[model samples]
Target: MNAPITACYPDPGTARPLTGLYLDHALPDRGRHGPFIYANYIASLDGRISVPADTGGQGVPESIANARDWRLFQELAGQADLLLSSGRYLRDLEAGTAQDSLPIGIDDAFSDIRAWRVRHGLAPQPDVAVLSAGLDFAVPRRLLDQGRRVIVITGESVPDSRVQAHERAGTEVIVLPNVARPGGAALVTALQALAYRRIYTVAGPFVLHTLLSANLLDSLFLTTVHRLIGGQPFASLCEGDLLAETGDFQLASMHLDAHGPGGCTQTFSRYDRTPGP
Candidate 1:
């Protein structure tokens, strides 16, 4: 209900709250993890993250809504440490598109990532780590060419042949146990081992759900657009018993776009508001 938030994001019938919500009971304090991990996403009013045909470009059915969505989207991307994602999102999003491919014969394209890392006192290029059962050769190649580290976390059953080739190419291919929990654990542990303390997981419902259910999400950033984007299938997390347990969550800081469109960007934040038993 902040003035600036409504003014910057004044779309009616929308849930564009200035400050969103954060729900976590694992950590006893705000900065519990050596470095906190932020899980971010954008959902429709009806809780959909995708369109019916999977052709809505990037989930927004309305132009204005898309603009607002991208504003927050870019902001989060600009501030994240390691952009962690799963192989499925890469394939579905065609993340292998050569549009930003290495910027061959040019040093210009690498500047952004380089500068961001330096500004944050991190490596020149943040690692673009993928959680996969095997190497995503096509995507990793492009990321590597852009000065980004291509790390593939796989399982024991991953084909031996591909693993060998990827390692030879200087890609960090980690093979973990064949269990589901171990996969994520291996990923977090490996990133930590490689000095990647702050990680950002941006992906589809399944990946997000896993982190949330595992109580690994330290923070969540979301952009709630103002529209009815029905038809898209979504994995709803706001249901019945889920609602009661989620109330322990709290809001930290609120940032209403001081100067911008009448649409506000809320940072629904909550630290360790309640003491853990």
Candidate 2:
């Protein structure tokens, strides 16, 4: 069942009209230039992104069981021109163990969003861009074989054979120079070249850490679940070496849905990067 959004903050004042799934306000315009990157994630109250010690550490399943969170996830997917993900994240979705709906599922739930995209001269579906350093992973065949544009961004460390395999599967490959951190200027330039302006990333902790550290993320959408799963070595929402200094974010909007089926209260918040002094 689709859950109704209980409340939205900073109510869309009378000035800007609300539309479709974007009930609070219209999506921000993506100008002719390229990429505005945002990310969406769900985490537990205790800040764990994954189940205790689970090797594959994809956090969606562990945190996003509530209907409200699921609906918000779909809404965010519908607004993006491109969806960025890590190779392992894509593989988890393909295996059906991610315990979350696919990006394509958004097409069915919110056809109006798709229609809006087409009217604005955008593709019927958002492009999926997967990042992998080694390029040694398998994604759902449907993602490649299906007529959707799938681009693989990898480091030169990946062998030519792997690159050819991805090409054979109908994916475009861009080989960037290997770096200590992958989400830097090169990745942004590549996305700009493709003319992808609004990019949404749904990924695990390591990927988020890289983007956050690089100061490439513009906004963050986070859902905090009521339940807590405590155990050793659980992954948090940002799982990498600690940043040299803290990153600051200002809350842009917040919503609360407390009437969940299992007495769960889910809070969805959008935070924009706080400017440096």
Candidate 3:
């Protein structure tokens, strides 16, 4: 069952009640020439994104037992024009026990959001874009088939054999200039070239850290579950050394789900990047 939203603050400054918020109407406006990047992540109450030594801890049975979170996840995926993810996350999905296709929704649902996309002259399904330094991981064969569009972004150092393999599989492989690392700027440029204006990223900590460091992240939609996972060396939502300058995010909206099963509480918060002074 879909959890009822107890409270919604659409505008933090005004704090007015927002009623009847649906996924189709809640999506952000796309830019004309560039991408508006937003990320969605779920964390534990103790601020852990993953369990110790296990990167796929977020998929544990105890972590994602909430129906409300799953509903929101599907809604976000259904509304995005493009789904950006790191190569590691893609590989993890392949190796892990998760579902093969994108988790758009359960029971083949989200018809309303799909219809909205079509009415707006957009594809019903979002394209998947994977970012990696080198095309070393195994790209999903199903994703390479027709009817599905997949974009692979990597540096020039990727082997010619790998590039050919992806191309032969009908994947659009983009090779950027070789650098110490593939920064978010390069990824944004590639996204712009493809005319993808609304991008939703479901990335791990490392990718989030890089995007945040590059000032490429526009907003973050975080769900904090009421659980304390503090046994092992878990990673946070943003993992890396402290930045010389910190990024500031202003809370744009917040929603509360108080009637979660098992006395659990989930708080959904949206933070937009604050413009530089």
Best by TM-score: 3
lDDT of 1 by residue, 72-176 (tens): 444444445567776665565464331122221124533443454466565544566667764555454556676777777777767789788878877777787
Enumerate residue pairs that collide in model 2. none
Q: What total of clashing residue pairs does each candidate reach?
A: 12, 0, 0
Distance from true location, Cα of 214 in model 3, Å: 1.8
Q: By TM-score, rank the candidates, best first.
A: 3, 2, 1
Per-residue CA lDDT of model 2 for 1-277, tens digit only, reads 3344444666732222112234235456453234677888777778766663254544544444565566667677777878888877766676666654345355465676566566667676778888888777766776655567888888767789989988887789888765533566676667678887778887778788877776667778888877776755777878888885566789887666664436777667888778662
Ten contiguous residues minimizing lDDT sum, candidate 3:
11-20
Q: Estimate each model's TM-score.
A: 0.66, 0.83, 0.85
lDDT of 3 by residue, 1-277 (tens): 4435644676333322222233636565564226778888778888876663344434433553466666667767766778887777676767864433664543645566566667766676788888887777776776655355888888777788988987886788888775535665676576678887678887778778877777777888888887776746667888888964687899877877764547777777888888762
Model 3: CA > 4 A from native: 8-24, 31-33, 52-61, 106-108
Residue pairs of candidate 3 with colliding backbone atoms: none
lDDT of 2: 0.68
The RMSD of every model to the true structure, in order and in angstroms, is 7.5, 3.8, 3.4
Error of 3 at 211 (Å): 1.3
